[model samples]
Target: MKTKLICALTGVGLLLFTGCTNLAEKVLDEASVSGLTDKQAADGNIAPVYARLPDIFQHTTYFALQEISTDEAILPYRGGTDWGDNGIYLALHQHTSTSTDPNIRNTWLLLLQGISRSITAINTLPTINDPASKVYIAEARGMRAYYNMVMLDLFGIAFLKDDPQATSDILRGEAAANYIKAEMLAVEPDLLTTVGPGRLSKGALWGLLARLHLNYAVYRDRYADTFTHKPEDMDKVVEYCDKLINSGQYQLSKDYFPIFNSDNHSNPELIFAVDQRAELNGHNRLAYFSLSGDQFPIPAYVGANGTDGPAITPDFYQSWVSAYAGKDPTVDPRFYKQNLSIYSNPGDSCVAESAFNINRGILRGQQYGLIRVNGAFVKCPDGKYKVGKLFNTTRNKPTLPVNFTEKIDFTVAGSDYSTGYRVEKYEFSKKSVSGRNLGDADIVIVRLADIYLMRAEAKLRKSNDAAAALADVNTVRASRTVTTPPPALTSMNLDLLFRERGFEFYWEMLRRTDMIRFGKYEGTWTEKTNTDKQKRIFPIPQTAIDGASNLPGYLVQNPGY
Candidate 1:
């Protein structure tokens, strides 16, 4: 008798099970088997797949990959020292880990499992006659394609199976790209035509295609050690981007914060976002990572409020301040919120006052004060380096001191000094904060602002003069803060455009791709310097290499592995 593995899909009555005697084989089979008319079959397959999304969404995997790939620095912690292990795999080239690190391997397996199950559902859903069901199935396919793209980007390979019941075979190089493109195109027609903003639409599918094709030069020849965008590929990028931008269904958000707000799932600026429900799968740790250390004002942190930490690096902060110099610092809220001190002036009645007083010689033990103001070093009244100000609003009169040991409770609303520039992207409801839940900010995968930038880059690559491209870029810039536009396209070059992109999309998860596209991926940094070979792809996970001994030469590890 065959053993039956039962699975359940809660909230959406779907159960799925597979008949296999071997538990490992059965779990793998159940993970990819989904053709249930009732809850039983659906739950068997769908639940396991859904279970992997939260794991993929974990900070160690998705968040870490996104941050390390970009210019952002990883927070120092154990098990993160070896660039080869995690940092270098992201910073340098494609990497495979043999270490018994569960975080790394679990991330890899979970992402692949997610793709496997999602594809299985997409391939098996023809039996379900409902159009709405088909649309959701298409969404699963699109998401699977997305996961494949990340795998292809990071690992330089993907698991492709033609038959749902067949053991997956890893495809590398151009073969992987071809498979992904075919899958995305197959599901394009079935996706929802007119979903609200931030939801997946046909346009986003094309955008994802554009993204994949834009990197074709790298994927087509991973071990070549040198890459340049082919003209034909650039044409395809232009073609797809034009279709999405001219689709007339999406537009840039008037304000930047709304794009990342908890209520921004339907914002018009978003093309696609990973839905993060604080109640269901709350792991938006970007807020916590980006907050300043002293910003913890909640009663739990001994401060009047929650812990506010994660300041912009001095170098990165200077880049933004330089870009919008001479403009009202308060105008573009994105700049202020992302770069400025969180605290307001002492006399100002703003609910969250500045924690550090620049005038007095008070420095909070936790907060790092402004080391430089308008390009000059800040000094205290006592002629010493004024690190930052600590504010005590709980007292009848707000007190400013270099260092204070007074303990204050943050139970009351005004009692907590919500001072300091914490990331304003994630909305902090009283419930979300007090409950210690992940912020429900939509993880925008693609946005209209990105389209503008892509078009600008493509046009710049084609026509040396990017006046039109600059106009498109400036349109997004204008929305951030009220400012007179810069001189009309006097100079538009790759460096300027690249820097603009860095400033605009700092932690939005496209930094590594953007850097590679502009030929800066292998350049040296303060902490990392990668070789040209490292620029092409990451090494296959050592486990994958160890598992597939039969497939000799078929699965060669990336160079330097």
Candidate 2:
């Protein structure tokens, strides 16, 4: 029985279920929602804001736009025409995408949906007139500020509406930045001080503020030759970062890989995350998006292997490899060397090693691991198992090995089914839901590691405290590498900072912003050459411009498109 939520604002209420991968589960969720009290309902109302993220961060959405726009990653046309959706990914890589790009349109709509949902929750959650509901109200407002910030970052404008019936107000450039900063500050006091990864809290607020202030110069002057980084704004970033860090509530995880694993929510590292569990409308795109069809990690849940979409660029992989010119790449803590014992010694089955072994961080080089056969491991003649070639699903033959190496082209017969490095940043979800592709790992929007880096950057840029900045970087490195931490820099500089950030937080929807702030957005990277400053902010999707009846004259496109 399909049931629709009816309210005075029927359309607005219905949007809560938008992009739901599973209808049966979503209907059941809505069914149970009726039993909750007004306060409970209000508290639960902000969930839609979180639900809208996977659509934004999915394999080929905003996250791809962010990473692929730089030297980090790219979505090359597989076998010439498979991923070639009118050359959108190619255009994005070449810095030639226009307003009509599907990703730009989809990302814009999803972000706006987040803003609308937050406003709906803020208006509805306040009805209980109870003091306890204020936290939820604050969370909703914080989320609204967050969604607006992201929209502003991408489109250079943010849409604001206090209530469902109100006219949408457009905040552009610095005005949008200020409004969002003020909103976060306003809600900071009322938010829950306790640690809550998915829900908004004071820690998340501080993290957001630190991020906004650190990038305030760019928001203030996007096209300037030299971005004006106000010391005052930098101080705000420091203040909030300190408050969150000093809280003693959160800490960076010991191992970097686990933080991106399926059960990452349990770690103290995540400050704010989109709760993307199998039970939720989460996606498995992040996990299996790049995996070969034959490399079945979890055979039961994902009957097939992977969709074979995006992959890491040779440039990004080289950045890490080049750094350790002579030394072992695996020793760099960040360069997670996986269970190569399986293929290194033939006839040895690494099926004994968990599926989650090399699934985290950058997957590169001669991939020595198990080959799935008959939905299980391939057995050796001695009854023990043998690692074999991962047959391409299209051919389903044992001809091609699962040896993931950095060699391939943009088109047909040239670019092998596997080209460039693959990253399973989010762990795969084993529990299958019909008509859905949900991953278990909660996609962390903000984590403790980000805070440390933010603080370090602010210190370096604002106060020129290299010692302090280097200290912050060392702390994270020390924790992750128990055997031998990364050698701390004798000095600090922007180039070092850029590489450090790439190492600490690659593939986390942060590369673009980091590149912009460091003025590297215009530099040559892989397929794209250094180009226009306007490319810093994407073109406002033309569809959004066409439907701006509410903000008729207010919705202006970014300079480029």
Instruction: State every prediction's TM-score relative to the real structure.
Output: 0.72, 0.89
Root-mean-square deviation per candidate: 10.3, 3.9
Candidate 1 structure quality by residue, lDDT tens digits, 329-363? 34444543322233444332122223322111112
Which candidate comes out best when scored by TM-score? 2
CA error at residue 219 for candidate 1, angstroms: 1.8
Q: Can you write out model 2's per-residue Cα lDDT over 1-561, one digit (the tens) per residue?
A: 245442222232323212322322233255686677776665566566577777777777877788878778777777666677998888887788898998887787678777877887787776665566778778888888998899878878866678576656777879989999989889988988674687788888889999999999999988987787999988988898898889899987877778877788778989988776645765547777777655665533336456667777777787877767787666676766454455465544534434334445677655544455555666555554455455564445467655566754465543566777777666566665421267667787888878888888888898789899888888788887544666665667778888889988888889999999998888886677858998989988776565453444655778877
Using lDDT as the measure, the top candidate is: 2
Q: Hey, what RMSD does candidate 2 come out at?
A: 3.9
How many angstroms is residue 475 displaced in model 2 relative to the true structure, after the best TM-score fit?
1.3
Which parts of model 2 are misplaced by more than 4 Å? 1-36, 129-131, 350-359, 373-386, 393-397, 408-414, 433-436, 481-483, 549-552
lDDT of each: 0.54, 0.73
